[model samples]
Target: MAFIPLSVPNMAEKEQEYVLDAVSTGWVSSVGPYVERFEKGIASYINTPNAVACQSGTAGLHLSLIALGAEAGDLIMVPTLTFIAAVNPVRYISADPVFLDCDDSLCIDPKKLRSFCEECCYIKDGALFHKDTDRRIPVLVVVHVFGNMADMPEILKIAEEFHFKVLEDATEALGTKYLEGPLNGCMAGTMGHLGVYSFNGNKIITTGGGGMVVSQNAELLQKIKYLSTQAKNDELYFIHHEIGYNYRMTNVQAAIGVAQLERLETFIATKKENYKLYKELLEDIPNISIMPVVEGVRSNYWMYSVCFENSKVRDDAIKELDKDKIQTRPVWGLIHEQNPYINNITHNLEKANFYGSRILNIPCSSGLTIDDVKTVSASMHKLQL
Candidate 1:
C-alpha cells in the first residue's frame, strides 16, 4: 500500500553479526580480518585467483587501469550507454575514452567494436592506434550492462587481435554467467583481464559503500592491494615506494560484505523470479518492450527495464506510477552527451540515444514481494489506456 522504492539493499542476513563483531573488536577502520576475508570470499565466489577490496567501484576501476599500465594520452574504449562511472576512470588515468554504442542487449556491440578496431584503427609496432589521433588504444572497458553479459567471446577475439586489455565492469552483473560458447561456465567478471564489482546499497549485495577488484592474475591483484592500502613497502616503517591512494575498503564495510556474500545466490534467485513476474505482467502493454538477457548468458536481473515508444510515453508512465505510489525512473542519459564529455568522439550512437529516451527502470529490489510487483504492474498498465 506504500510507495515501492527502486533497488534498495537487502539486509536480512548476518550483516548485524559481522558489523557488530568488527565494532566490538576495534577493527572498524580499513585494517582487520574482515577485509581480507571478504576479498578472499569474493574471489572464491567469482572463481578468480585474487580480489582486492576498495572504497568504491570507481576506485577499483582506476586502480585496475593503473596496474594494467594505462598512461597519459592513451585511448580506452567504453560503451556510451553505460553508467558514467564506467568511463570516468579513463579520465582519472589521464587517458581518454572513445565512446562505443550498445546493441539490443544494452551491452557493447561486438560487430561495431570489430569495425572500429579493424577499419578505423591502424596497427603499428604491435599496438592498435586510432588513425586520426594516433593514440594507442590499449584497453577496452566492457560493462555487463544490467547484469547481462556482452558478446565477450567476439569482443575478446577482437581484443586479442588488436592487443588491448579487457577490463570488465561487473558492478551490476556480479552473479551473471555465460552458459555457452568458449567461455561456457565463466562468470562475467572473471572472463576479463581485470573485473570490478560494486557492493553499494543498490547492488544485489551491499557493503554500504564498497567494491572489489578481481583477477586471475595474482601479481596484478597484489599490486592493486598495495595501491589500495597506500603502497607501503613496510607498514611498520611507513616507507612508501610509489604514489598510492587511500582507497581501501573499511573493515566494517568488508564485514558487512562477508555477510552479504553469504546470501548472494538467494538474492540472485529472487531477482530472477521478480524479473519473470514483471515480464509476464507487462507483456500485453502496447508500444513497450522488455530488455532481454542475451542468449547465452544467465543474468542476475540487477535492474529490470522497459523500453517505450518515446520519451513522452515513458514520462507519462513515470508520472502515473508515482501518482499511484510506485516509483519508476528513466534510464540514464547517454554518457557522451553529458556536459563534461560532450566533445568526446562517439561512434554510431543511434541505438544509445534511441534507448536513452525510451527506457524506464522499474522497482525490483531484492526484498520486493509478489504483491508489490502486482501493484506496480497494475499502476503501469493504467498508462497504456
Candidate 2:
C-alpha cells in the first residue's frame, strides 16, 4: 500500500492550464496580470479592501510587523503552541516575544493574556512595557491554529485597552469563519488589523509556495506591497529610499494560486466532510480525543488531529501506525522549550504543554478517499485495545 501523507496539495488540470498560459504569455516573473488577479481574489474572499501577495507566510508576518512600525527592542505577544513561523517574525525584527499560553481550543488565551499584561508589565511614559526587559509591548500575533478560531471578541477588547496591534495569523484558516457573537459572519483574516494566509503545499490550497497579507488600511497594504517588491519607486530609475526585501511571489506561483483559490470552497467542504467521518469512526476510542470545533465557528479542519491521554500512549500509537505503513506526525514541540527560544519569557502553559505531548496529526489531505480515512481510523481504533 502507498503511504498516506499527513497533508498534501490538491492540484488538477486547471493549475496546469494556468501555468501554461503564463508561460505562453512569457510573463513568468513577478509583475504580471496573474499576480494582480490573485491578490484581488484573496482580498475579495477575505472582505478586505487591500491585499498584498508575498513569497511565504513568514514574509507576510514580517511585512506586517514592518508596516505596523514594530521596531527592534519592542515586544510582541504570540501563542507558544503555534508553528514557529508565527513567532519567528518577531525575531526577524529584532523584537522580543512573550510566549502566551493556549486555552481549551489551542488558541491564545485572552484571559491569561490580560493577566500577564496586568501582572508582569508596567506603564512607562504612558506605554505598556515589560517590567523586566523594559521593552514596549506593541502587538499580538493571534494564530488561528489548525483552522480553529480564537476568541477574537475578548482578544480585540484587550487589544483596544492595551493599545497593541492585532495581526491575525490565519495561515491555516483561509475559509474559517466566526458564526456567532461580535465577529459573527467575519472571516478569520479580516477580523484583525492585518491578516495573513499561506498557500503552502500542505495547506488547504497551494500556490506551490506563497502567501498574502490583507488589511482594511489601504495605505498600509500598499506599503507592504512596496516593501515586498524591494521598495523601488516606480517613477524613478533606480531610487531606493529605505531597506527592502525581494519577497514578491512570481507570476508562475500566482498563476497556481489563482487556480487554487477558485477551488478553495470545494477543498474546505471536503476537509469538513473528512473530519465528520473521522469523528464518527473514532467516537468509541477511550484514550483518544479528537479536536473540537468551538460552537458558532466554522473550521476548515485544516489538519485533523487526535490527542492521546499522554506522551507514552501517543508514542506507542505512532509506532503501531508506522508498522502498518500509515503516516502520522507529532505536534510541534513547545517553542519556548527549543534551544533558540529557551530564554524567552513564557507564561503558564499548562494546557499547551499537556497537548504538545499528546497531540498527533494524521493524514488529512483534500485528496484523501473514504478508504484512506477508514484505514487511519482502524489504526487509531486498534490502539484503544
Candidate 3:
C-alpha cells in the first residue's frame, strides 16, 4: 500500500477546470472577476454582509487588526492552544498578546478570560485595560480548534462585559456551526465581529494558499478590501494616504477558491463520515480514544484526533505509525511556550498543558478512503499488545 498522508487537498472536482480558465483569461492577478466571485460565495455561505479575499489567513488576521484600530500599545487576548499565526498578528500591530487557556473543547476558556479581565484588568473610559501594562485590551482572538466550535456564547459574554472586540479565527472550521442554543444557525466565522478562513492545501478545501475575511460591518469590510489592495486613495494618480499591504488574493487562487466553495458541504460530509468510521473502528480499543467535538455544535471534523493515556504512549504511537507508513502528529506546542512568546503573560493554561502532550492528530483528509481508515485503526489496535 502507498504511504497514507496527513490532511491534504481534495482536488478531484472542478479545480483544474477553474485553474485553466483563470490562466486562459489572463486575469490571474489580484484584479479579476473570480476574486469578487469567491468573496461573494464566501459571504453568502457564511451569511455575512461582506467578505474580503486576502493572500493568506495570517494576512486576513493582520488586516482585521488594522481595520479594528489595533495600535502599538494595545493588548490582544488569544489562546495558547492555537497555531502561531493566530498570535503573530498581535505582534504585527506592535501589540502584545495575553495568552489564555483552553477548555475541554480545545478552545479558549471563557472562564479564564473573564477572570483575567475581572481580576487583572480594569475598565477605563469604557475600554478594558490591563492593570500591569496599562495597555488597552481591545480584541480577543478565538480559534475554533480542529473544526470544533469554541464556547463562543460564553466568550462573547466576557468580551461584552470587558468592552473588547472578538476576532474569530475559523481557518480550520470553515463549515463548523452551532446546532442549538442562542447561536443556533450561526456559522463559526460569522458570529464574531470579524472572522477569517484559510484555503491552504491541507485544509478541507484549497486555493493552494488563500484566505477570506468576513464581517457584519460592510464598511469595515470595504476598508479591509482597500487596505488589502495597497489602500490607494487615488488609483489614477497613485496617491496613498495610509500604509497598506499587498495582501489581496490573486485571481488564480480565487478561481480555485470559487471551485472549492462549490463542494465544501460535500467535503465536510466526507470528513464527518470518516470520523465516525474511525470512532467505531477504535471504540473498544484501550489506551486511546477519539476526541469528541463539543456538544451543541456541528464540526467539520477536519482533523481526527486520538487522545492517548499519556505523552509517552502518544509519542510511541506516532513512531509506530510512521514505520507503518501512516503519517501522524501531535498538537501544536502552546503559543505561550514558543521562543518568541516566552515572555508573554498567560492566564491559567492547565487544560492546554494537559492535552498538549497526549493528543495525536491522525489522517482525516476528505480524500481518504474507508480502507485507509481501517488500516490506520487496525495498525493502532496492534500497539495495545
Candidate 4:
C-alpha cells in the first residue's frame, strides 16, 4: 500500500492549464496580469476589498509590520504555541516579541492577555508599554492556529483597552470563519488591521510558494506593493525611493494560485469530512482524543491533530505509525522555549505547555480516504492495547 501521507497538496490538472497560459504569454516574471488576477481572486474569495500578493507568508507578515509602522524596540504580543514563522517576522523589523499563552482553542488566551495587559503593562499617551522590558507595545500578532481562529472578540477588546494594533497571521486559516459572534461571517485575517495568508505546498491552497496581504486601507497596500517591487518610483530612469525588498510573487506562482483558489472550498469540505470520519472511528480509543474546534468557529481543519495521554505516548504513537508507512508528527516546539526568544517575556503558559507536549498531527490531506482514516484510527487503538 502507498504511504498515507500527512497534509500535502491536492493539485488537479487545473494548475497546468493556468501555468501553460502564463508561460505561453511569456509573463512568468515579477510583473504580469496573472499577479493581479490572483490577488483579486483571493480577495474576492475571502470577501476582502483589497489584497496584495507577496513572495511568501513571512514576507507578507514583514510587510504588514511595515504597514503598521513597527519599529525598533517595539513589542508585539504573540502566542507561544504557534509555528515559528508567525513570530519570526516580529524580529525582522527589529521589534521585540513577548509570548502569550494559548487557550483550549489552541489560539491566544484572551483572559491571560487581559490580565497581562492590566497587571504587567501600562498606558502612556494612548499607547501601551510593557513594564518589565520597557518596550513600546504597538502591535499584537494573532495567528489562527491550524485554521481555528483566536477569540477575536476578547482579543480585540483587550487591544482596544490597551491601545495596540492587531495584525493577524492567518496563514493557516484562509477559509475559516466565525459562525456566530460580533465577528459573525468575518473571515480570519480580515478582522485585523492587516492580515496575511500563505499558499505553500502544504497549505489548503498552493501557489508553489506565495502569500497575500489583505487590508481595508488601499494606500497602505499600494505602499506595500511599491516596497515589494524594489520601491521604484520611476521605471524609465531607475528612480529608487525607500528601502525595499524583491518580495513580489512571480506570475508563474500566481497562475498556480489562481487554480488552487478555485478548488479551495472543495478541499475544505474534504478535510472536514475526513476529520469527522476519524473522530467517529477513534472516539472510543483509550489514552487518545482528537482535537476539536470551539463552538461557532468553522475550522478548515487544515491539519487534524490529536492529544495523547502524555509526551511519551504521543512520541510512541508517532513511531508506531511511521513503522507502517503512515506519516504523523508532534506539534511545534513552544516558541518561548526556542533558542533566540528566551530573553523575551512569557505570560502564564500553563495551557500552551500542556498542549505543546501532547498534541500530535495525523494524516489529514484533502486526498485522504475514509479507509485511510480507518487505518490510522486502528493503529492508534492497537497502541492503546
Candidate 5:
C-alpha cells in the first residue's frame, strides 16, 4: 500500500497557468499584477476593507505588532499551546509575552484570560498593566488552532474590558467562521482589530510561502504595506526615516495563491468529508477519541486530530504507524516550555498541559483517498488492542 501522508497542498491546473503567465511577463517580483489580485481576492472573501500581502505568517504577525504600537517592555498575551511562531513575533518587537492556557477547543481560554486580568493586572489611566512585570499590555494574540475558531465573543469581551487590541492568528483557519451568536457569518480572521492568514504549503491554501494581514482599519493596513516595502518615504530617491523589512510577497507566489484561493471551498469540503469518515471509523475504539471543533463554528477541518488516553499511547501510536508507512505526529510542544520562554509568566495552564501530551494529528490531506483513511484507521484500531 502507498504511504498515507499528512496534510499537503492540493494544486490545480490554474496554479501552473497563472505561474507561467507571471514568469512570461517578467513581472515575477513583488511589484506585479498577481500580488494585487491575490490581495483583493482574500479581502473580498473575508469581507475586509484592506489586506496587505507579506512574506510569511510570522512576518504578518511581526508587522501587526509594530503597527499596533507594541514596543519594548510591553506585555502581549498569547496562548502557550500553539506553534512557536505565534509567540516569537512578540519577542521580535522587543515585547514580553505572557502565556495563557487553552480551553477545550484547543484555543486560548477566555476564563483564565479574564481571571488573570482581574487578579494579576491593574488598570491605571485606562491602560492595563501586569502587576509583576509592571509592563503595559497592548495586545492579545489569539490563534485559531487546527482550523477551529477561537471563542472570539468571549475573548473580545475580555479585551474590551481591559482596553487592549486583538490580533487574530488565523493562519490555520482561513475558511473557518462562526455560524451563530453576535459573530454570526463572521470569518475567523475578520473579527479582530488585525487578523493574519498564511498560504504555507500545508495550509488550506498554498502560495509556497506567503501570508496576508486584513483589517477594517484601512489606514493601519496602509502603514503595514509601507513598513513591508522597506519604509521608503520617496521612491524617486532613497529615503529612510524608520527601519523596515523586505516582507512583501512576490508576484510569482501570489500567482500560485490566486489559483489556490479559487479552490479553497472545495478543499474545505473534502477535508470535512475525510474528518467525518475518520470519526465514524474510529468511534468504537476504546481509550481514544477525535477532537471536536467548538459549537456553532464551521471549521475548515484543516488537520484531523486523535486524542489517546495518555502520552505514552500517543507516542507509541506514532512509532507503530510508521512501520505501516502511515505518517502521524504529536501536537507541538507547549511554547512556554521552550528554552527562551522558560521564565515567562503563565496562568492556569492545566488544560493546555493535559491536551498537549495526548493529541496526535492524523492525515486529512484533501487529496487523500477513502482507502488511505481506512488503512490508517485500521492501523490505529490495532494499536488499542
Candidate 6:
C-alpha cells in the first residue's frame, strides 16, 4: 500500500498558469513582476506596511536579525521546542540563543521567559546583559509553533521591559490570528517588531521555497530588502558599503507564491475543517489527545498534531501508522539539547521536553479530503483495540 504523506502542497491550476506566464515572459530570475506582486500581496494580507521576500525562512530570519543589529555575543531568547531553523539563525549571526520552555500549547512559556530574564539579566551601562555570559540580550524570536499563536501580549510586555527586539516567527502560521486584546484579529506575523513567513513546499502555501519578512517600519523593511539583494546600491554598480547576503527569491518562485497567495483563505478553511473532523473522531480515545486552539486565538491548523500518553506509546503508534501506510512524524527535538545548541543556557524545559517526545504530526495537507481524515481516524481508533 502507498503511504499517505504527512503534508502536501495544494497547487491549483491557476498556480501552473502563473508559473507558465513567468517562464514565457523570460522573467524567471530574481527581478520580475511576480516578486513585486507577491511582496505586496503578502504585506496586504498580513496588514503590514511592507514586506521583503527572500529565498527561505532561515534567510528571512537571518535578514531580520541583521536589520535589527543582532550581532556576535548578543543573546537571543528562542523557544526550545521549535524547528532548528528558528534557532539556527541566531547562530548564523554568531549570537547565543537561550532556550526557553513551552506551555501546554507548545508555545514559549511567558512565565518561564520572564522569570529567566529577570533572574539571568541585569542592567549594565543602561543595557540588559546576561549575568553569566555577560552578553547583551538584544532580541527575542517568538515562534508560533505548528501554526498556534504564542502569548504575544505577555511576551510583548516582557520584551518592552527588557528592551529586546521582537521577531515573530510565523513560518508555520500564515493565517493564524489572535482574537482578543490589543492584537485582536491581528495576524500572527503582524504583532511583533518584525515577522517572517515561510512558503516552503510543505507549508500552507508554496513557492517551491521562499519566505517573506514584514514590518511596520518602512526603513527596516527597506534595509531587509537591500540586505537580501546583496545590498546593491542603485547609484553605483558593485559598490559594497556593508556585508550582505544573496537571499532574494527568484521570480519563478514568487510567481508560484502569487498564485498560492490567491488561494490562501480557501486552504486555511480546508485545514480547519479537516482538524475539526479529526478532533471529533479522536475525542473518545483515552491515550490520544489533539492539540487545542486557545480560547482567544484562531490557528491555521497547519499541522494537526496529536500527543500520546508518553514516548513509548507514541513510538508504538508511529510504527502502527507506518504499517498501515499512513505517514506521521514526531515533534522536533528540544533545541537546547541539539548538538549545535547543547552548550547554550536553557530554562526549565519540562513541558517542551515532555511534549516533544509524546507529540506526533498527522496528515494535515490542505489537499486531504474528508474521507482521508476518516481513514486516518479509523486507523487510529483501531490502535486503541
TM per prediction = 0.98, 0.98, 0.98, 0.98, 0.99, 0.98
RMSD of each: 1.0, 1.2, 0.9, 1.1, 0.8, 1.1
Clash pairs, candidate 6, are none
User: Given candidate 1, what's the lDDT at residue 183?
Assistant: 92
The runs of at least 3 residues in candidate 4 whose Cα sits more than 4 Å from the true structure, single-residue gaps closed, are none
What tens-digit string does per-residue lDDT give for candidate 2 at 133-231? Answer: 788988899999999999999999988877788999999999999888888889998878899999999999889898999988998898898899888
The list of candidate 1 runs beyond 4 A from truth reads none
Clashes of 3: 0
The Cα local distance difference test for each model comes to 0.91, 0.90, 0.91, 0.90, 0.93, 0.90
RMSD of 3: 0.9
Q: For candidate 3, what is the lDDT?
A: 0.91
Q: Give the true-structure RMSD of model 5.
A: 0.8
- Which digits, one per residue and each the tens of the lDDT, describe model 3 over residues 64-169? 9988878998989999998899999999999999999988888988889888999999999999999998889989999999999999889888888889999999
Q: What would you estimate as the lDDT of candidate 6?
A: 0.90
Between 4 and 5, whose lDDT is larger? 5
Which residue pairs show collisions in model 3? none
Residue 124 of model 1 has an lDDT of 92
Per-residue alpha-carbon lDDT of candidate 5 for residues 302-367, written as tens digits (9 for 90 to 100): 989898899998999999999898989899999999999999999988999999999999998889
Q: After superposition, how far is residue 84 of candidate 5 from its true place, in Å?
A: 0.3
Best by lDDT: 5
Model 2 TM-score? 0.98
Q: 3 or 6: which has the higher lDDT?
A: 3
Model 1 RMSD in angstroms = 1.0
